[model samples]
Target: MLKFVKGYMESIEGVATYPMISLLIFFVFFVILFWWVFTATKEHIKEVSELPLKED
Candidate 1:
């Protein structure tokens, strides 16, 4: 099964670059997410975290 799928992928033209582009996109997304989490304010985090327990 694995060999069949690999052969199918290999048959497609310009398929190799797809994996690299997808990896670059995933890496960039996590980098931005980490930056946001680290730079977030402590007070803002506390407020958002307590929202679930607060009454409407």
Candidate 2:
């Protein structure tokens, strides 16, 4: 299995550059995704909370 993966990777043209590009793309995607989640969480926190109301 290891040999197969190694052979497959080696067969690709410009194999060295492929990993670098993949890493960069993943990093950018993760950053954007985290930023989006952070903004959404902040918006959620600002909204009202659900709790039982007590009668005076």
Candidate 3:
């Protein structure tokens, strides 16, 4: 099954760049998410964490 899929993918033109582009996008998203998490205020984190226990 894996060999068949690999052969199919290899037959397509420009398929190689798709994996690189997807990896770049995934890396960029995680970097942004990490920056946001690290830079977030303690007060905001506390407020958000308590949201589930608070009444509507």
Tens-digit lDDT track for model 1 on 1-56? 99999999999999989999999999999999999999999999999999999998
Residue pairs in collision within model 2: none
Off by over 4 Å in 3: none
For residue 11, give model 1's deviation from the true position in Å. 1.1
> For residues 1-56, what per-residue lDDT tens digits would candidate 3 score against the true structure?
99999999999999989999999999999999999999999999999999999998
Tens-place lDDT digits, model 2, residues 1-56: 99999999999989999789999999999999998877786546555232235334
Candidate lDDT values, in order:
0.99, 0.80, 0.99
Per TM-score, the best of the predicted structures is: 3
- Runs in model 2 lying further than 4 Å from the true structure: 1-13, 41-56
The candidate, 1 or 3, that scores higher on TM-score is 3
Residue 30's lDDT within candidate 2 is 100
Minimal lDDT window, size 10, model 1:
10-19
- Compared with the true structure, the alpha-carbon lDDT of candidate 3 equals 0.99
TM-score of candidate 3 to 2 decimals = 0.84
> Which 10 consecutive residues of model 3 have the lowest summed lDDT?
10-19
